[model samples]
Target: MTDPADGQAGSDGGHIDSFDDLDIAPRVRQAIADVGYESPSPIQAATIPPLMAGRDVVGLAQTGTGKTAAFAVPILSRIDPTARHPQALVLAPTRELALQVAEAFGRYSSHMPEVRVLPIYGGQSYGVQLAGLRRGAQVIVGTPGRVIDHLDKGTLDISQLDHLVLDEADEMLTMGFAEDVERILAETPDSKQVALFSATMPSAIRRLAQRYLHDPQEITVKAKTATAQNITQRYLQVSHQRKLDALTRFLEVETFDAMIVFVRTKSATEELAEKLRSRGFSAVAINGDMAQAQRERTINQLKNGQIDILVATDVAARGLDVDRISHVVNYDIPHDTESYVHRIGRTGRAGRSGNALLFVSPRERHLLRAIERATRSTLTEIGLPSVEDVNAQRVARFADSITENLGSDHLDTFRQLVENYARDKDVAMADIAAALALETRDGGFLMAPDPPEGERGERRERSPRRSSGGQFATYRIAVGRKHKVSPGAIVGAIANEGGLTRGDFGNISIRDDFSLVELPENLDNETLSSLRHTKIGRNPIDIKKDHGPPRTRGGAKRGGGHGRDGYGKRSDSWGKRSNPRVAGRGRG
Candidate 1:
């Protein structure tokens, strides 16, 4: 059930290169081929073997590191598709992730038509879930709350469950689902094989593993970066909604022979390609979902100059070597820094100079910093292309076109026709030429209005800060003086786990039973959820929006009501008294 080399995830070992090197079912292998995946990611290569061997595994990996397929492929090999009940159960933190994992299982089991994978989560009708259950599912992927609800209702049974997976385990614990997860674990049979995957390992998650899992094989995948020195790296911080406008503007201003725009999802590749085409750019998409023949054809078109822009996902772009590529644009920032290095490496091949541009959102600055630190090269901050810059390029292109066509035989005929028209209409020849130029521009003016001043250099549309004269929202956490909690520990835990910077937090007031802290208003549900269950020194913060002054509902020490602490506490010097276990490494 466990390996002798337990708790040695940080240790390095030999890595597998291809899926064929690992033990997998024939049908599953065929599915992988159909998906166009030739090689296994580092996490997949390291995780698949131990999983197929039926050993408990604790995988330390990020969200976009191909961890889903890492477990799905091998689990499908062990699954008995003929069985009517659930043989494998996966617990995810959110419904979106639950659906994604279920889709992954279905994709890997495509060759095995008998296998049925079902996703059960909240926000769906109970009737649908019951119907899916009656139809018989070999694999069930659901959120912890819904899974527990099904267990209590006796509608789902896992007494004979053979495989269990906790996807984003740290996220589930941070969302305050610890008790629900334990309840589900208690109902499962002891013989079941468990696999836990988390971006970070906090003490709370480590304790959960220690109590429940057998000697598990701990596998840690660190972000490794290798970049070419000839490549020029730059970044522009913009919001998500403004990325397209920014991308198109860059395409107009930047001179690129051929370019690749990398996005995260397969659907995004197609979606972005369509948008770029609509904007008068020749673009195409390639993803794992595309057929091999179609993918090859698309690549050929890129190499043959049929298309100058290719929008692609990470997996589909692997092993892509195009000498003509002069630019690479990260339209969507990757979740891992290794991906950043790989994406930009597509260009600057064969010792040619290349340019790499990254688009970072306000919330994603941390990832940008991580990439910089890993690559040991600072990305130059760049501003958006001004309207004047775009107009200058357009004018130069118009002039070049005129020069190239001046000597053509066909141009003589057009010149004579234009002269006759000018004589017939008695109009100035210069006016005629200007009218023709307007028509050549598709009836759009060559010069456009300038954007608002400072729009070009606006890096981040920052949220109103609590330290400044801005609105604030008070939140209370369960940990306080009684838990030996410190402000630094609280800030470090929340900032590290919630992806918030030090500036995001405000004043801190530690009470006997609880502590109240002021934060910026309008925090997203996901961030709040993560901060709510984040722990400080072995205790869950249990953070919630404080409606009014925090008052003791039950017995505790005196001075129960929360008072106005103002924004007096410094965000830094949170004191070295911070607990080491409270902080977790940011996913690369």
Candidate 2:
């Protein structure tokens, strides 16, 4: 296979000038013209040539760089239209992205009537997907989970697959689809070409590429795109414990027509939306688990003024465009800057002024700086609204409420009641009115009192001594020094299996034949079960909650029960050192 010179994309004569210069199928070129695409995007220009030459590729470009066409055009150029089974498979992280990639494939293959593309994902009926598969699609675009389901059921056959594309591979891993993605790749033919694309190359992603990809061509598009000038971006450095309180106070003081709050987990979307609703906001949640019909309804509610706030994950909110979304709140900071860009892009549409607020914890300040450097824009630092600020806004809103009710026909009855009460009790009219107002309020307070001096809204992190006070839980896995497992491998396995980030893990202590890890105390049963079966090399983790003291494989205590005894000293396999990070956040 031929390689591009220096493996870099430029506007010079070294690169393909336009769509006309791409040595792709004639029908695809016609479809490209029909879709009004003229010049090749940087990613497309750098990616297509190697892909057409049947070489593995690793594309590193931020969102909105025409990455879809970069891979789609090339795949469509080479796939056999008359194949009975899928010739190309694309794994996406979310259902929305799956549908989007499938649509792009269909559009590019419009002139090739014999070629068919099928999108399989959660929330869609299996019967429908099975029908499409039976009809023999040439290209399959699917999320990892649903694709795994089909593969296990023997309905979708990719044995003859010639091309495999992992789009937004980092997002898939972040959402806990790493195992599914690996299994799918393992199932594909050995000769299949692989293309892995991500906005950022984290250690996990690099390890995946190293293991699965051949000598892939690497292409990177500098993430220096212009953000909307009308969008005001700001960040608040608040502790994780204070985020909810800060968000509520910000909502009270900020004048917003509509807002979207982005979180990392699907469960978090629902939890945050519920919290917002309890706090009296018209809020709802959307995620990949919801049916397509329900997702559409939720989005429609936002557009038609029925819901003021949408709490969503990155995948659920992909391609979401609402002109009335005046504010975008990053309730949970994204794993990378690419996701941050996508989250804020939901607002600032049609040249309208918008607000983008990011909540960054102290531990995540590095991520904040990364975003700033990548976007080439400095985010203004802001503090959460103080009690006084909230109270002032509330008082103004109360006055406006009184003004709005002045012309109401029912106000005379209440006014007469207040007058009668004042006359009977011989109380001042102002005092009577205040009493009535207090009675009407649920919490019975029109103004907020100032907090104690130096005590703002932030809460201290939990003491490590407290076993379950929002701290880490110790779990023992059956693989350790004897199994030849390193601390990094164990960390990666648990993080991927649990769909957790680095912050979720605290410390790891490896002993002879068994290892102990400190993870978040709130891990659900399903995640624990998944981790129990996760393999480091050839041994299943067999993980379980460690209620007893740490022990060796022979059931004897090694040293003190304290997990951080060895700290940073590396000893023999029987006395390997721990992760060495602090016990709370493990970010030493």
Candidate 3:
């Protein structure tokens, strides 16, 4: 017999005419209509019914596939406005993502009066989070660390949790919060409905599902295989420090109707936009913190050509469909493969061909590979702009501006002044014009000289042979295989934490409970100490020479392989395990 939760009887292949057709409450239907969503996305269509029926679901969908609404709509429908306890817990990896999910819940819960949502993360004050908890939020969205902190302090009680969601399970694992996740789940009641969403099902994530979820109904929404075929993908493998310079150079040489530059943080959006504005570009920043009126005005300016460039974080840029956006710049490599696809999707809309440029630091090369594998598209390498190229573009733009201004009567006075200067200086008219041209150009007349041959800013070439003859020096990190550290995590940590450019490191090998990385041999002791203090996935580095068995700073055995759960096993002072909630069906 067909299960009632399946809701497949509509005969239109699960597509509902309205939220009413899905047996949802009137408030939910009104909220759905207010959001202007006429039909459910594929993932939404498949997942919502079972969710509304209170069945556990495991959804596999790429970012931007409308997964947020898939679970959100059903969960919001289940909210009892008077109860005021945490009935739904949505755990995300990053603070930014947690805020985004909270905002989403707010949007869909608009018609449901007295429904409150709170987002908790590490950077915020615990007192503020505790206050919100006291005020009785119906739904809680938080990062694992902060959520675990709250659970242990007796400030958060999830005994009433009817819904538990693990958003971006793979990302939580990649960030080394798996053990914390397990602990969070262990605190939840076993009967709670759990939803674990991820883009990829790696072994670790699969193990999480097996251990925590109970006969979950799996739903996978395949990512769009091709970027809008209309978009051309190009990337420049530059260090993070050089990205601004590279982007500036690219802007000088390339022309576009309007451009969207994607950055990782809200602060970066403002900072980059301000820098571009100071550099004479009509630019602005868009982020989630902006008021609705402000966001609309900024977007309108871009559409009307008043703003030529917009620096924005991903959450603010979502649902923005602008026909004038001709270029998309990944100012920061996206956090995951799906984000790459979404950032590029900002352009190339409405059958328009667009250009996408990705700036990749050496440490983010693994992200590049993941994106390539996910999208099945090749990204062509883009070279830095030459001085000649910048000069040529400047000259062309100057001439065009002059020709346009010549049609105005105001040029007559300037023309006479130029003629007077030419006659007084006994300079030929052409020479006088040339001098004026040179003076009018921006970026100055003299270009900076290229670096010397061995230091031309190209990545240092490394020999595969492990001998000291090469430019790299091999150093051992005290946490490795037994610690559950992967080579990619090592690379990401060093590149982001140690301030080492991707080109500053080479081959990496993972051994039992530690790893070794080949870095530039010229690294000073200060840099080495800084590296030793660096933390990857929240574990401090005991970076020392790779002699043999793992030892403490004082040379004694440092316990068994950083503990069984690897970096995720660290304990918190708040009376709870610091591990991320295990992928599971329980509520914490």
Candidate 4:
């Protein structure tokens, strides 16, 4: 096997069928097999060899995809067991994960008595950790917060580090520990091999990857069930009257790098592609009806970034492996559950999270339920972006376009021209800018003005604002986009059918199999009974009061979170030490 980085021969590369193929110490292999790891998972198989070869790797896969062993096995194989100073640092998001990872290291190197590992985290005794540090450990696994605390006091050392791992990067991004993670990485030697594993690559994490990781090989592993835990599955309940419009609204608000829209028929693929193109989207269609050459060109255009969206039937999209595609829209419900899974799998590839939206009509409820049961994960229902949402996004995009041209050579010419016109008309610069904003958007909103609730009759019930909190119950509705539900229709059905006012409701969240609604806290039995047998559009809703104990009166968690525990120090640690500067321009 050859290395992609420096063209060096790697004795263990490509597929490995057994633990022995990993080329690690015999004791390490024995311990792995003793734990009953019969075979390496896809991520472990692909990543272990590159990592073991000392190449930087970025692992892309969903949660629970066996990422721990992928990096751990390789580092353990390469580490000098006799060294007492820490040579590797594993950074995780939470204290629990830190401990779990340290335990795994212990289990993997069970026979190697000289190999020492330390688990550092908040809520642990500092004296204990300091003693372990003084005694010297070869591997250190810690959460980012606690790791920074040690770095501040000059107690922990990475001057001789060989490996650095950033595990659960997406979780850290969510917990707002990205800055800490970056700072900690900066303190490490540049020669150290870096490995990062993330369930999703939102732009922030992507930027961090670009800054920190050297040229790295990318690997992606699909979930064992062939469905991704990272892709958000949603179904939009649309009447035939509004399917096209609902889809258009979605395109307006979504942030995607590339998109694929699937339809049942070849002709629908072409038609939808043309319709989207007419709306100024860079869209083209590929179908069984297209010539092979034409199909190839369309796919290439999508792959090369010339086109942003592809409209294709399942047959035409076979063997497609484009990682840039970030969204998969089932513009038409699939004939079966397998087709549904295959279509969405195209987007959420290489460990990047993708969004999947389905357009289900009134009679497609059973198909939606079948998909949910097969995937073993419930989809979150989301409302169509309102007119305000579309308008806000459009204006923001126009502002970006103008800002991009700010450094152009001819910008002064245009800037002066606008200034002269403003002076002649005695108008405010702000007024001139607002007029330019309207003109840039083509003198109209990106979408037609959304109809008021009364204007659309029963289907026009406006969604209530999301509740701030305070005992509003989260009710579950069996009906969803599968039943052609619009938020307006949901709000209307509940208000008129259940004798509740608009104020009695809060924001609604829909899923493929069901929908969640916020209702006034502690409604009377009479009102709750009236909510039964409520019909929206063509389907009757099976509504019930939901009981979720984890949620508090107003929605936020009771303790905020365990992540922000102040200064993870033991009570008796060398009297009261000043809290180290946690986040700023530079690390102490």
Candidate 5:
């Protein structure tokens, strides 16, 4: 391999001027042209040349700076697709990201057609992944934990691995999977080409890179501006259950040419987009599952202003350079600072100011702080939208539409109909207009009352605390210490099942055969019924009263031998008890 310099400098300091300029295969250039990527990102520009030349690379780039293709193009170009052994291994911090990298490999290798890609993660069954490995997947993308599990089981064969990519290396370290990563890397061939990409190079990550990577080229991509300085960053500290409502309110009130809403999961992208469409917004979901053609159409719609909002996962929003996007709403706060930065970076582009709104549940406050520190930018606190704000925006939109369309030739018929209605109802024009305006508003005229002050805060506070006392009801679940069920699982299950606020539940104890959970005493029958049907792990709870038998009025069990601690025959237990009434009766 030749140490050739490509003129392309990607944002992350990689070179990608020309595929021919580097030592990559001719097929890679064809594939790159097919994908319509004329130039490489800085990370890609700098990393690809060194990687193709068999030199290890340490790249520092944020999530959306085209890092996957950087390593992927080089690895795929060098690997023998017919070998059918794992030649390239990419480790990601998350299952979703692992899957995303796998998909990118598949896309870039569409021309190759023989290169096989596999994604392994915790949620997937191990047996299936093992079978895939047996059949031969040339490239493997996996999380450290699952990959380690496979390695320990002897199901994964990395002995022939020629190239290794540690994507999000910093995140894996933070998640405490550093040891597993080290073990996995140890299994690779000694002559393997290693490339480590991270958003931030902490001391641990730097040390790991120094120990593992050979004389590697260092590349870094810094934000050109401080988190889109023109974009106003704000967050609504609402509970998860209330995020949809809050999002809807903001969509109605905020004016924008177009908006991109980032969600964490593919399911969330579709679900939220569906809800927004039902609420009469022109919205569509963009995810990895969508074909390139469909994704292009969606982006076209967004650019042409046909779709007012786009609900998308991080992967789908990559390489999006739409100038009309006036807002980027983090429907779900990203899992890491890198993802947060990428999500907000969609807006405030092309010298135009933009708006970024993040929806943060109280549990994710730590993430908020992390993002702030990483970006060196402050996120302003924004309260949930009031009914008045929604109403005012609705009215303003209605008035604008009327003003724009009232002079059109088509409005004569509607004008006549409105005049007829005014005459028939004996109402003035202003009253008629007011009635029409009220009817046109989406959430009906009356708004649900703002929840009591401090109620949401109290619920947030109760999220981590366990409940105690008979003041709360106890539920028995079959899974106990054996299933690794803990207080957190119990709490999460109940919260998800009952749709009850965290404050409504309390302490949980896991016994050998079952677990006891304390729920609020005033839980309505509907909530209790829902809880009973809610499944935790594979067991549905038998939600009932607590342990112990019935007690008498004197607070003594019916068949109890004695109330005293160890009085042999209940000797003088009641008679010797120091009580004013008993003493008086004895004297009499």
Candidate 6:
């Protein structure tokens, strides 16, 4: 049965301060809370209610303004999670982006739990793709080539699909994927509700939208700068593996009433929150997949000082307003300046002086620059907190706690108990107090010896294999043209997962079955382990050490980021973006 939540689409064109103002399902509302969004982005506020009313939307907005959720929320609220069979399909220009959109859908449907969102791209094995299709996923996000491939294989049936999204349509035509896109659209039922979102609508895209989208409401969002002048921005360059430890260390030394630590994925919010809770910190997780009731409770807890730390993702943290939020930490750097601006804006509200600390890996320095340019302010580079710093702060804070308790009447009860126990056991009063102090520090875990000085960035180690030229071993990834892979995608995944500089790469040889790439020869075990689990096009690289010199299959030279036209595209312009933090679901 079609969900009645879709019937709530009639509640359009109203000013809303919160997600609850929309006439959507309770669970969908709850999922919004889980996401922890500060509030609706401009585009979301303008387009969502009409879309909820089942109206076709023609949106002219830049990416990174939260456009994904604008359509995702209304669509998800209407879909029957149990009767899953490709009820919605979102098309992107490249395979890399198809996966990101699919991840977004998966996050949105987390509240439903049973709803399936599958990503199909060419580089992935047909067997694996077929398995997901057979399982009856409700939403399918894919690139033009792979979506056509699935259609030709009769592995995808869109007769049941009620919604279709052409995300970044101008880029699709620019990349010459127009024919493939049209084919997919033709296969869909004409009764489907279509949404065409493009940053710049060329005549080609406009024509495509004219034919496919039926009497759509024209929603245009003018690019507007959103900034918080009161925010003091700072960044720290820490390796991916050490980010969590670095964050905990800073929390120990920094002063704040409330804090929001932003991560990239939904699972990360929960994982980081759990880790913080284990360390005796008050924390909670907020993401797009949580129930409305649970999300409300979490917000209430934060408001009441029951939890001081909120671990969140971009979508979940939208429209969240809390006066006590004195600090915002970008645990994962945002890919777009709009998201970065919005992230740090969570604090420093209402003329308050609040500062945001961003964590940057060596490879993500470009993102740091992008934020600086967008905000028109230089971010001071800060060093990670040393073990000595953390321990000293802990000692001072513990001492203050003891001093506060000295005059408290509550100590009167424990005093007599300690005296009675010490007398019966013939133990010294100081010895009994020591036992209590041991328990006071939670089994002395917090008082453990700090990380070693070498690991504390105190000394540079001279390794036998460390290379200055970066002429390290060449590794191969099993994704190329057949997988609809782009060079930028390869660079993005490697630099991110390997925690190496994005520019550190040497020659890249992308083959039909695999690609050869040169990187620093002496990678640590942690990076190598991360590379093994990492997927280039959702396909594992099976990273072999390549004990011998680099060899190319068929002697194919490494390629640049070019589409079908063979124009050498810049890395920044790879997919609907000339820069990493510029392109996304919305504009700045």
Candidate 2 — number of clashing residue pairs? Answer: 0
> TM-score for every candidate vs. truth?
0.67, 0.74, 0.74, 0.40, 0.67, 0.60
| lDDT, residue 391, candidate 1 | 82
**Residue 28 displacement (Å), model 3:** 2.1
lDDT of 2 by residue, 1-588 (tens): 101101112222225667878789999999888866677767788888999999999988656566788788899999888777899999886655676688778778899999989998755567899999999998999877668777778999989999999998887775556777899999999899999989789999999999989999998865434466889999999877678888999999999999999987676888999999998889999986889799999999999999999999876886578999999999988756667776787888998998999999886787888888867899999977888888888889889988999989999898899888888989999887677678777673444675664565332323352222256778888987877766655655565445555456656777777887777787778777756656665577898988865668998655543343432323332211232322222110
Q: Poorest 10 consecutive residues of model 5 by lDDT?
A: 579-588
- Cα deviation at 361, candidate 1, in Å, is 5.5
| Tens-digit lDDT track of model 4 for 393-425 | 987987788788887999889889999998899
* Tens-digit per-residue lDDT, 433-547, candidate 1: 8898888667664547755648744633454434211357778889877776666556645654454433356666676777776765777787687566555545777889886
Per-candidate Cα RMSD to the true structure, in Å, reads 8.7, 7.0, 9.2, 25.2, 12.6, 9.6
Badly placed stretches (over 4 Å) of model 5 are 1-20, 36-42, 56-66, 125-135, 148-156, 176-179, 182-187, 197-225, 228-242, 360-385, 399-443, 446-588
Ranking by TM-score: 3, 2, 5, 1, 6, 4
Worst 10 residues of 4 by lDDT: 579-588
Candidate 6 per-residue lDDT, tens place, 486-541, comes to: 55556545554454543345555555555666667877677677567555444666
Screening candidate 1 with a backbone cut-off below 3 angstroms (N, C-alpha, C), the clashing residue pairs are: 336-588
Q: Which regions of candidate 3 fall more than 4 Å away from where they truly are? A: 1-20, 202-214, 361-369, 416-443, 446-449, 457-588
lDDT of 3 by residue, 326-378 (tens): 99999888755667777788899888999999998776687788878877898
The lDDT, on a scale of 0 to 1, for candidate 4 is 0.71
Model 6: ten consecutive residues of lowest lDDT: 1-10
Better candidate number, 4 or 6, judged by lDDT: 6
Q: Flag clash pairs in model 4.
A: 61-351, 237-481, 381-510, 381-511, 461-488, 469-554, 470-554
lDDT of 6: 0.72
